[model samples]
Target: MRNLARPLLFAFIALIISVILSIAVGSVDISPKDMLSVIWNTLQGIEGSTQLASTYQTILLTLRLPRTILMIMTGAALAGSGCAYQGLFRNPLADPYLIGAASGAGLGAILSLSIQWPASSFSYLFVPMTAFIGALLTVFIVFQLAKVGTTLPVTNLILAGVAVSSFATALTSLLLVNASGELRRALVWLLGGSTMAGWKPVISQLPYALIGLIGLSVLAYKLNVLQFGDEQAVQLGINVNRTRTMIVIFATLSTAAAVAFTGVIGFVGLIVPHILRRITGGDMRRLLPFSMIGGALFLLLADIIARVLIAPQELPVGIITSLCGAPFFLFILRRSKGKDW
Candidate 1:
């Protein structure tokens, strides 16, 4: 426990700094002083009594705050699920998207976008709902395909994921090619740009994220036990099949919620947990929470770069993460070549 303290504290501090930077460094910079004044005024129940301009206050409250919170949620969801996947499979390379969840979610989102639904509150619910369903279905199919007489081999799982993900990607492309509504927006989303802004997405996604993250945290001990192989885990009094199912369901829930809103941001889960595993050891008890914090810090910093890298012409946050994550992924792949993770 003592060994976990310093890294956790450092991660939290970094997350705080990233959150501050994310809120402050947007197009119209809001200084720390003005931000504090706005917060203080709001806390005092003195609306419109701040020295800061109204535009700054509105941006802070309506735009940056929700977006920052959303990013943190998305990051935590992805990284927590990724860590769980790695533990469940006993494979260090496993990621949230490893089993076709992202591709399936993308297909669902594109399907929703292809329709010309009325601009109503209910319309906001369709995309995410469909996306979540698609993700669950994809995972189900992949699980069935990968199972070998009641056992799921890591190699088979990866292969099934690739095949199913490829098919889903093809379907998504076909829809995008023929779609008549919101084509550009759909394209941006496919490339990992956020389309939905403001608080609605954050609010809608919160419940799913909470269920998934908290569920994974609760099962962290089971994940550690499962690392010893299915037979061993069962002998140790763990219900291997049930635990595996719960992990998958929880991971898919979090991954689908994140992908439904944030587009298919890659490598966050793959990168964060692997790094932390090396630093803190492979104990899932500590790895899950640390990965959540590290993921939030990472994505917040990536988002800050996305906003400022081109200045006024913001690139997708996914692009920034891919740029950084791709090389790190390659390095890990090389290191793991010829060895079982």
Candidate 2:
């Protein structure tokens, strides 16, 4: 209990601080007093509180609030998915996009933009919905390719994901080359950004993300058994293959939904899980929730950096994460070299 409490408390505090910072410091800075007034006025459904500036209210509603919600949701989804993936594969290096989900999702979004699909398609859920399908299909393909008789080797699975991701990326690039006017849109989706700041975007993604999180939570105990290896897992009455399959499916769904809306944001999935796992021990039950909060906090901070680093002109959120994540990735690689996880 103490072990779980530590990460949870740290993550909760970090999340609160990150969120407040995200709200306060954007292109237009709002003071703490005004921020509170805006929140109060908005909640009371009053158009104007005498003390509130309408512009600040607009910024809070039209920009900061929705973006914050999206960030929280996307970050949690990626982090939770990462935790699930790592546990499923028994590899700390395993990320949510390990099985080509990001690449495939990008390809789907590119295809959507390339075809100039109407927003009315799928009730304005066209790009995200297509991306979700593509991600799921890509992981399914990678799983099938990695299968050998009754067993799946982790090495082969990683290799297969790499190959599929490469293929999907190449295809996406080809579409981009022919994109003409849609090139910027294609590039943004492939690279990742949080330009979709609205309630619709948040609400659209919430259901799939919630479903995936719940599924992983239910399977947490079985994932712990899986860490003991297949023989031990089977002896413990855990169906290893089915559990792995479900983990893949749910993690893919959460990751797909996140990437579909936010583009291919990396490292939240990779970095958050590892950080929380160290604090919370190897228990999936504790690790999953901690990873969720930690991921949310980390990405919120990264997004803040992305927005303010260039002032009025914002960098892609993916770039910030990759810059921060790449070094950490290498550090972990060096530490894990010639050692069994």
Candidate 3:
């Protein structure tokens, strides 16, 4: 209990601090008093309150609020997807990127946007739908390619993912090469940014995310069983192939929905689960919830840095995470002595 208590307590505090910082620190920099007034007025459904200045209110609603929600959801989805991939593959190095989910989604976004698709219909809404479909298709194609004469092999799945990701990346670069005004926007979406997300975007993705959480939560114990080698897992009566395929599908869907809604946010998926697993002893029961909290908080803080580091001119959230995550990844590698990959 004491061991479990620490990460949980730390995560809770980190989340509280992140929310406060996200609300209080922004371009306009609202005072805590004014911040409260805005929250109160917004929650109370009153358009204007003497306590809330209109400028501050706009800053809160239009700028900071949407970005924060986008960060949280993106972070949570990535973290959860990373956890699922790592557990299913029994490889700490595995992430959504390894399976071509992110790359494929980015490609889907680019293809949909580069064309003159209806902004109200497909470009905005169905671009993500296309991305989600692409993610699933990538996974399915990889799975099919990986089958070794009727048996789905993990090794083959990984190799296929690598091939597809490389191909998708090349295609993305091609789109970037032959581009113009709105095409530049498409590239930005591919590179992944949270600057444009808002209430409609958030609401659009809510159902997919909620469904993913519930589905993965139910399969958490099975994921743990899979962490044991396949023979052992099968001996324990878990369907190794089915579990792996389902986890991949569900994680891909969650990831696609999130990436489609926002863009390609990274590292939270790669790092958060490993961090939680260290303190929590690799139990899915514990890892899932704790990872979600930690992921949300991690991105909340990272997004704040992206906002403040340049202040008034936001850095891409993906860039900030990469800068932080790349180093931590090396540290993890060193700690492992380059073994057990």
C-alpha RMSD values across all candidates = 1.9, 2.1, 2.3
What are the models' TM-scores?
A: 0.94, 0.93, 0.91
lDDT of each structure?
A: 0.85, 0.82, 0.77
Tens-digit lDDT string for candidate 2 (212-326) = 8889999888899999999999999988878888888888878877887788898899888886666787889888988888888888999999999999888889999999988
Provide the lowest-lDDT 10-residue window in model 2: 116-125
Model 1 RMSD in Å is: 1.9
Better of 2 and 3 by TM-score: 2
lDDT of 1 at 31: 91
Clashing pairs in 3: none
Which regions of candidate 2 fall more than 4 Å away from where they truly are? 49-52, 118-123, 332-340
Query: Cα lDDT for residue 282, model 2?
Result: 86
Residue pairs clashing, model 2: none
So what's the TM-score on candidate 1?
Answer: 0.94
Q: Order of candidates by lDDT, top first?
A: 1, 2, 3
Stronger candidate by lDDT (1 vs 2): 1
